[model samples]
Target: MQTFFIGFFGLAAVVFAVGVFRTSSMMRSALALLFSQTALGALFLAMQAEFLGVLQIMMMATEMSIMAIFMVMFMMDPGGLGGMDMSHQKRLSLLAGLGGVVLVTGIAAYTQWEGLASATEAAAADEQIRQLGRELLGRSMLVFETAGITILTAMIAATAVAVKVPEQGGSHES
Candidate 1:
């Protein structure tokens, strides 16, 4: 059952991720990215990383919403109503993508990851949650701070992308 779910969402993640770039519309691309990230979150759940899974989904949902908003505000055809050309360097991208896959496959096949703890070593649910909290707020303070900074930066960038200077002779207020 676990294996089935893992494979299902793993495939879904790939499909939605591809959909992100395959679509012509910026809004649709953002939505596809959101679904791809959510699929990854489901995979994480299958592996029992519940906290990280939920965090992944929530962060992507927020980030993609912001991206869609900025696109709609800034782009002339956010919905691809003009049937804008979205494809670019297709053959080169495919070759590079294939090379990347081969490299990753080689690494996964040959690498020996050492000293990883088994799932049984982890505490029960409540204790695991407390441990995660302690690690995030205490020993992993830098990570938390970095995540906060990243979110702040994204918000700032969205505002910058979406906002336009008013015309000198025109009034924004009515």
Candidate 2:
């Protein structure tokens, strides 16, 4: 079962990577990235790292959905799936992305880490999960509330920028 789960995750990751690279539409790329993150989360779960997996799903899914919606709302010809206009900005963006990939790959290659000898032998695993949940819901309540407020503010700001208010009454121009 574990091997099957791993294989499934690996296939999902490859498909998402192809989508990210081959898609011309920015929205499609974003969706692909979301799927990639989701697959990674599932992989973590399959490896018995539940907490990180849940966090990955929550944050990446929410962020990608929000960005995709906003892009569709704000971009011209949102439905058009044309190739991206590769300008100097796009070139720069690609270079930055490449640099980030190299950096992360390097870090991963250099890191020396060992996995738990026995997953079942971990002390207080259940208690640790409970503690984490308590901390997130209790001590981190304010942080979560603030994040909601920030999202609300961003929505209002986007609306203000995109929506034009009509004049209250017709006025004669000089």
Residue 156 lDDT in candidate 1: 100
lDDT against true structure, model 2: 0.80
Scored by lDDT, the top model is 1
Where is model 2 more than 4 Å wrong at Cα? 1-11, 25-31, 49-95, 112-130, 167-170
Clashes of 1: 0
> How well is each residue in 103-145 modelled by candidate 1, as lDDT tens digits?
9999988877555534444466677689988998999999999
Best by TM-score: 1
**Per-residue CA lDDT of candidate 2, range 1-174, in tens?**
988998899789778976876665778878899999999899978766778788899999999999889878877755445655534576788889889989998988887645624445433546768877787789998898899999999999999997988767557543
Task: Give the clashing residue pairs of candidate 2, or none.
Answer: none
Let me know the TM-score candidate 1 reaches against the reference structure.
0.76
Local distance difference test, per candidate?
0.89, 0.80
Lowest lDDT 10-mer window, candidate 1? 113-122
